[model samples]
Target chain A: MKNNSLPTDVEPAKTDPRIKLITAKIKKENYKPDALIEILHTAQNAYGYLPMNVLKFITKALHLPPSRVYSTVTFYHFFSLKSKGEHTCLVCTGTACYVKGAQLILNEIEKQFSLKPGQVSADNKLGVSVARCIGACGLAPAVVLDEEVHAKVSSEEIVNSINAKIAV
Target chain B: MPKISVTIDDKKLDVDVGKTILEVCKENGIEILTMCHLKGLTDVGACRLCLVEIEGVNKLLSACTTKIAANMIIRTKTEKIKRYQRITSELFFAERNHVCSVCVANGKCDLQKLGYKTEMNHIRYPYLFPECNVDTSHPWYVLDHNRCIMCTRCVRACGEVEGAHNWNVMNRGYQVRIISDFDTPWGESVTCTSCGKCVHACPTGAIWPKAIVQGQLEKKPEIIGELVEKRKMNL
Candidate 1:
């Protein structure tokens, strides 16, 4: 396909075994037009993020409009259009977490790995993002790695955990 | 269809069935404030300016999309409704960089009139100050994302009325944007007809002709309904 300079990242997504799994999922849904949301979830699972090519492929495969697919991905916070590294790190920036020095943790992680909010590290080992009040106000400053939430996290603890993931 | 009696601001009237509260309000000479409720387009209930308090319903419902129920005791103007209207208008202003003083729509903007009707002297919320784009790729018009309120009127106008399907929304709350043709420049659109329907569809100065400048914009959104009405005539 001829490239049209899409807004997403330049690095093309790899054609791995995940495409077959995604195809099977789409087939399982019988290509229902209303199954867009569920198909998008499957696409995200197949690709770490909903890359532009993956979105286009799904649009054609399911016979859905491109705008419908694009708008849905953009409307939901959980769906990402950009690449997320192998390991994801999220810092709670909710009012409660901010007062508890969540900024320090974000800053420390950024400085240590040279990562910014919503960016996958060049090494593709870690990605940094911020959350607003993850409902862990009691924990004050909380950090989420992959799926587990760490409460009352300090600057040093965040740096070490990221390093531990990076080391892997 | 059955006609039912309803009271709007203490005035008793018999309204037809299947019509929305907004349509009935308009028919009865009652004024209801609106921004995203353009004619000839499907209502997505994007703007909350026309929220009316019903006697039975606990929550304020949007008048544009909600069908009038039988015996509906509708209140278009109340102390609480006015307060919410003022706040919603203020939030619309503060959500983006709406520099009315230097805008192309200037005094001719609907958003400005909404502010005046709500008596909004100042916005209580802090300005979002999002870094929006100015897409002047089209030869005639420009899409200024800064002044956009995400009402989706342009998106509907182009797709539903114009049959272009060029303008599409991208992203979620607060960070959402109206993109033209796969998020590319508008000038490069493969589907746009350059009809300027989206320009007329916009409530603010978000979409306008490049031939005009500040305070020079003149739009007639009412023409959308007129066009739809004329098409139905088949004369």
Candidate 2:
């Protein structure tokens, strides 16, 4: 993937394919300023996060004010300004989940990776985060690695699942 | 636009159909507390302060964004509204490190006035104590995230009024921050006109001129509205 429209500030290799995908998405939207959210979603797909240069590129390409774009990005829970790790881990902290030892699981993940919520591991292998609720109360405590839901995850099973999945 | 008759807090008044409930209330001298609202900018409804009860609506709606409809019964001073207002004010204080005792906008802050208006004695919720940044990179201004409630008035004012969209938000939830030109230092921004519109747009001491000290910031937010009004005249 190559983005001919990619901004110069970013490196050529890591940003190229994503910028190409993002550019395609922008073209698909016809570069409408009001389509900021949709474009950001596509950018996340391409780049894993909304990089500063990419955001700047989008603001210019869409002809929207930079502040407006920024405000919208930060206001939404789904948006992220940083890159996700090769493996993404999400722990639900809903009332049900919390009571079922979600906190312990979260703590273990942090301990295992030495990374906090919203932080990627130094090795770039794991990204740790917490969700308010995943609507999986039956699972009590759940961990989502990538799109696959690990329901009813016990505190003891947390580390093993993350390590096994990442190893695969 | 057609005039719609509506009852706001038992007072019947005919207002413009397309105008928002907050605008109607403002025209009729009904004070609805707000923080994210700036007369000159677009309303994002981020702040829930102007929430009012209306007949037939089960949930309270923010007055700043909802348009006035015919025969709508709006209650601005309901017990529910008052309770929520207090909770909202408390949440604003609890969500950040808003230590007003030593703040620059101690006396002039709208958030403080909102606290007083809501009669918020002390916060029941635990303080978030989020480690926030104080950006002094700008030569003339300081961006103190400690006092920020994320009202986004500065974001709107910078974009809609000054036409300099330098200020934007970064992150999510209580971790959100107002970033200048894609999370760069304010002094290093290429788009910042250094207009200081954000300083006036802020309801709290999160943004202030660098030269100002504790309890000394005197912001005139009305000037933004005045400027907008003047622009309409096309001078």
Candidate 3:
């Protein structure tokens, strides 16, 4: 049977600063396997998404199995295996938001940019997604553009905002 | 090991303390419907079919995971449990494409047996019909996502018995999937030993040998528990 362990001496590419950041975080955690989730959080924050190679690095460093690492990464919603693109449009489809035409905003965005929820544009400029709720229910039919909440905005206004950001 | 008294379906009996309600019921020949449960493997209680109502407890607990307690009053065949089991069976059918007529495990599938046991006449909920992939990447086995019930039996069997954690669950909710090593193709899995333990662990046609055809697939899930027992004998 083949050994699944990687040599401790083998390190990830030294040129990438993001790797250095992850290595530092792992070191800070003392390379304890129990801190796997904490280490994953640092890696995700550095790379915006958990890339395969980075995941492999963590697996090797923690002396954990590949499936263990991958399973943990895939379980949580906060972690993303794929990039969320340069600009993101997150529409809230909570009971309150859906009651106030949240689906219409989603439709308008899909019509304008040809991007559906959980889909990224071919150019990788814009990505669209939906949330159950962001707890901003008072702002019914709310849309989030690049981490900034656009409260009570019409579908046309949201589309124009996305166009303005991604066009640049 | 002292025995404890418990009343199950109005039948009072003295059973072992550490044994689960399901284990006690099974030993005593009390019928309790279950899925996602296999002997000799760890009990995860993923399937809610084994739910039994306990006196003073508001919610029904799974028999497989809940241990028997002293002077406990347990009811397994209540009308509420029957209703829930039927609902669960219907949801399992409606969640994916379980076209039994075309399935390889058609007549022998546990899911089909479960439907019969629960008396599932027809599904009321709309079928999700999510486009699932059938991975024929392995040289000897095939992994069909459509037939999967998200039971972690294969995952546990691979990890605990085979000592190869090749199988793992990815994503969540309706989008959950059984992925092989970083969601890559099974044939390309660096960790998989191709032991075929997962084939036996699977309760559905989600994983099966490539050689079999419709209704011809034979699975010996009992071998897994027997294997564990035999290993303890050190023969």
Candidate 4:
């Protein structure tokens, strides 16, 4: 058993191998402007979300204004500044799906979970969002839960599906 | 220029070799409504508003993107085409905060103009006005996430045209938004030149000149096309 094992330093120690590896890579790149996207991608992958210090380090290294880096991240939907849920559900509400009662299916799920689309469930079980079209119009009124797609769904089916997943 | 004949609204016409059906129609005084595909930017083919039926092509092709082929048969203003365009326009209005009366780009906006041309009435679809924020932190421009159509015209203008690469679009599907650098605030983003070209390229009020009065918005005509031509000359 270790006594007084709490870390005194708030920051991760320089001796930590992860930090050293990142620093070595940064040194090798010497921070070109073109590498801004790559660095941000690496930082987000490593740290989950970009912290202020990481952004600052990127700013200095890339010789780019902090605004430029921040804008690129915000402009494209591929990157996330905030930590997202492990599971994301995308429902199709395109014209084809809309005609087939896609809205009702989404409403039913939201009512059952008290979670709006784009909101993570209180238990962090799911994050839901409505997509314009997921290229599955033939499967109209489709509700995609994580990687699985449920088609021709009723309100009851949505509720049961959620309950079943939750029970599991 | 080589000549190619095509039909528009069932009227046959001979057009230049390499021009799109849209360009042919425009030259012959035909009106086709669009929002996303600007003359200057590389055709994105996202809107699907410009879709027309070609005799041989089974799938509807974007008039703006598809170049004219010799003796190509085409049909415009068909019931199918009208329905598709109307639905797409309705979706555009429903997805964003396009409350025209209060919007800065009310009269002058391309989306509004498209709505006018299409005679879009009563969005049959439900609204998805996601709770987006307004960033006035940028000294010269206001970035309203609600009004953005996600056309990426502004993004293209910033990166490809202005060569700033300050703006980008974040997320997939409905959660997507135009992000300045690193998903930070507009003022905080480093790549923004504050050139205001993005504001010009935006078809809606998503990116607008700061405090543009109710009756004061006017779109610059042919600026993007002119700029593209100028750039091509330089290249």
Q: Pick the candidate with the highest TM-score.
A: 3
Q: TM-score for all predictions?
A: 0.82, 0.76, 0.85, 0.66
Interface RMSD of 3: 6.6
| Residue-pair clashes, model 1 | 2
Which order, best to worst by DockQ? 3, 2, 1, 4
| Residue range B1-235, candidate 1, lDDT tens digits | 6889999999999989899999999898999999999988898888998999999789999999999888889998999999999999999988899998879998888999999999999899999998888988899999998899889999998888787788889876787889875576888876789998999999999999998877678898878888888888987
**In candidate 2, which residue pairs clash?**
none
How does each model score on lDDT?
0.85, 0.85, 0.89, 0.76
Compose the digit string of candidate 2's lDDT tens values, residues B169-198: 776766778888756678888889999999
Candidate 4 local lDDT, A74-133, one digit each (tens): 555556555445556677899999999988888887888877877877666666778898
Off by over 4 Å in 1: A1-16, A89-119, A129-168, B214-216, B230-235
Pick out the ten consecutive residues of candidate 1 chain B with the lowest summed lDDT.
Answer: B181-190
What lDDT score is found at residue B88 in candidate 3?
97
Candidate 3 stretches greater than 4 Å from native? A1-12, A89-132, A136-168
Task: Judge candidate 2 at residue B106 and give its lDDT.
Answer: 85
Kindly report the docking quality category of candidate 3. acceptable
Please identify model 4 stretches exceeding 4 Å from their true place.
A1-16, A19-168, B233-235
Task: Judging by DockQ, tell me the better candidate of 3 and 4.
Answer: 3
Q: Which 10 successive residues of model 3 chain B have the least lDDT summed?
A: B176-185
In the range A42-150, model 1's lDDT, one tens digit per residue, is: 8787667887877777777887656767778878888987778789998899999999999899888878888888888777788899988789899989999988899
